[model samples]
Target: MTERAADGTGVRGRRKRPTMLDVAREAGVALRTVSRVVNEDPTVGSHLVSRVQAAISALDYVPDERARQLRRGVTGTIGAAVRNLTDAHPVLGAIDHNAREAGLTVLAMSTEDEEAREREVVTSMCRRRVDGIIIEPISSNHQYLSAEVESGLPVVAVDRPLSGLEADTVLSDNAAGIGTAFRHLVLHGHRRIAYIGDHERIFTGRERAAAFRACVAAHGGPLDGMVHPGAVEPDRVVAALQTALGGPEPATALIAGNAATSIEVLRHLGAEAGRLAIVGFDDFLLADILRPALTVIAQDDAAIGRTAIELLLARGADPTHPVRTVTLPVTLVPRGSGELPPA
Candidate 1:
């Protein structure tokens, strides 16, 4: 039966997966012969092999690799636990590409930024005996993974360090990025720069917010309603915007903490966004097309991805080697918003 969505619209079900039995029937051969052919048995008659190969080509039958890997005792698979798989994920693509180059396949799962889900997916990957795991950690305490790490399961963290474990970590230079944004705004003659971002519980959020504070302190600016770090909801962002722009010490410039915060600030400002000098941390798609074009600090994603795979392989080869943390530098892309004179 066809499935229907909650709205009563017809929705397609999963495609009917072709099976080995289907291949055997198509080739007019026994199921054991099909399995032997798939396993590349040299003793099988060449004619039978050719016939099975032809059937495989005609039906596009892809043999399951996991069962074979189990028999061989090494999966040659690494698992990736990213924040979301459904969203735009350039980093995840890079990781996959690099892993492929290393003769390894990647199994990616989404954590949805939930600690419980992260743990569940990672544990599931372990149960399947993946060779290694690369994680964008979200949990407050990852003591659960200590056992796996101790047992020599190669684990590498991307974007944030794993809690309660000393594993290989790859991070963007958050402090340098924030400093670049702050200086770019300051060079344009703006001293009262406001910031709004995610709650400090998140690693990126904490690093960015702290970096912004350091910038403010170094410049000796009044830390009034300028620093607002909390949930990324619409209400919280709007409230922060109001506070920064409404007070007697209203800010003439803004530095957004992340890509999401940059978007929220732009949405709230609308036409007025042009009047205020702005610099954002983390460039996003279409940032160049926005009015006055957003200036941002962009991380080197390709390098980060490649380096992550390198670290994972290195850890696997020599577990006794000292664990390493790599912090890649960020670049500043100035379009127009960040260069505007204080208004």
Candidate 2:
């Protein structure tokens, strides 16, 4: 026996979705009158609007927004392709907040930091004909988006630029953040400082590691066994820590390249974390609560988000506008960890 619906229909028990025709029939009005009422045409009489609204309420009608948006030749929604949805993403939150304030909707999808997944998610968004797109790009080659872009689709890249594509981009000053972290350690009387960060294959990791090298050169500090850039995994971070701290000329201070790497370094250091002057590149939640609270170079997550939306909207408004890249600044927050004397 087939399962029955709440209305006891015989054929698979699937209830048909109420349509505008049903609403019009119930209201004793023509189909065109119902359509005009649904669209909120200014010329529709108040009495007819009331009758249609009552019929709609009686049938619990829910309009198909996608259909209406298609008929209007535009969707009031934008798509956001981000790295991941599992972690706390302040930038994504800001994007959603700003989008709502602009009378737009955000449809977010996670790419899991994979190149193939980024392509798939972005392609899906394009197929859905979203008004615009904001992406935290992970792919090495975004030429896949060329056709859509050429066809006037607005795209904005956040945190990193789109490879092989010219589009609007928003970025934090990665090199400056690293420089500030290095200088902060030097000011704290640390002559021998080591840097550990994300893999150099990543854009941020490359910029930050290069900046650290520049800082070391400017200070005439030893570069040998000082810069360690690689994956942020536990085993790799532990090995890098050991190498940075175990050399004949061990470093007295350290700069973690990113928040995850900083956490891994702190976890490995345990109670010994206070013995070394440390500054992380990115600020994270509860960083201030740690013993000898973590010092960090903090990125402006809100500005990045808001700027991305602004660029996206601008592109949508005028596709012929010049492609632009906006780089925001970072701040150094002094805490106990980065101020420790060389030990």
Candidate 3:
């Protein structure tokens, strides 16, 4: 006779799970010997190891990895707190690959770009006793992590730095990339270039917008009605685009601050996009296939990931060392769109 599930969902009852003691009884060996064999102790003789293995196979027994890891005082897992899970996150993939190569598992959780969610996810990771943490910060104040940091938890910030806490960080060179985009547009005979980007409250947004201002000042271009730094919303972006292109001295070219802004600008322009020269910061999926493929300042996603893992491991190996910040370089990928002449 078979037992039905407690909820009467038609799922069959499970067999009595086998335990370590059952394995020992089956092998006719002491419980301690079975424990040693399961733990891979080299001192166990060959004959005993073979007998224990046969018994384990016959009973279909599985060792409790969580209990074993607890006894060893390390979980062999790392936690990654990132912005979202729905997007194509190449950096996260690289981090996972590198962590696996180092014999560690990655427990990834999305923060949904919310400070409260970030705190909840990170706190849960801490409760699980993860060996280290890699975070893409969304919080304006990370002082809540001070206690954990002081207690020797290894934390590495990626893409952006933690606001109030000092930790190892990996970042792309934002200012330099902005400069490259501005110069690229200038080289193509676009003196009246406009800039549209993320909100100034964001770290990258602030850096890129400041860099654009500096470029315009140095080149003697009119700054008025040209630089638009605000929320990346449809209405805001369209208004900014109109202001840049509507005036008598309308911009001949545009530099988009980020990938989302670039897409927004293009979506607003439609078939008219071909008339204006454009350069965007940060590449995105399917960008290369757009008509007049997007020219972009691309961050080195793989390097960012590899370097993040390296920093994480180094932090774990020597928690007393001074915190380090590594800023990787960005590259300019010129496609058809950025090369268009002023309309």
- List RMSD in Å for every model shown: 13.1, 11.2, 11.2
Tens-place lDDT digits, model 3, residues 1-343 = 2232212112222545677789999999987788778767799999999999999999988654333322332336788999899888999999998877776678899999899999999999888777678999999999999998876578999988999999999999998998998888888889999999988888889989999999999999899999999998999999999999996899999999988899999999999889999999999998899988999999999899889988877665545568999999999999988999888
Residue 132: error of model 1 in Å? Answer: 0.9
Against the unseen true structure, what C-alpha lDDT does each candidate score? 0.83, 0.85, 0.85
Instruction: Indicate the residue-level lDDT of 243 in model 3.
Output: 98
Candidate 2 regions off by >4 Å?
A: 1-75
Model 1 ranges off by over 4 Å: 1-75
lDDT of 3 at 331: 97
- Candidate 1 clashes between residue pairs 3 or more apart in a chain or in different chains: none
* TM-score of every model versus the real structure: 0.77, 0.78, 0.78
What is the Cα-based lDDT of residue 171 in candidate 1?
A: 97
Per-residue CA lDDT of model 1 for 13-118, tens digit only, reads 2445566778899999987788778777689999999999999999888654333332232336789999997766777888999888776779999999999999
Kindly give the stretch of ten consecutive residues in candidate 1 with the minimal lDDT sum. 1-10
Clashing pairs in 2: none
Give the C-alpha lDDT of model 2.
0.85
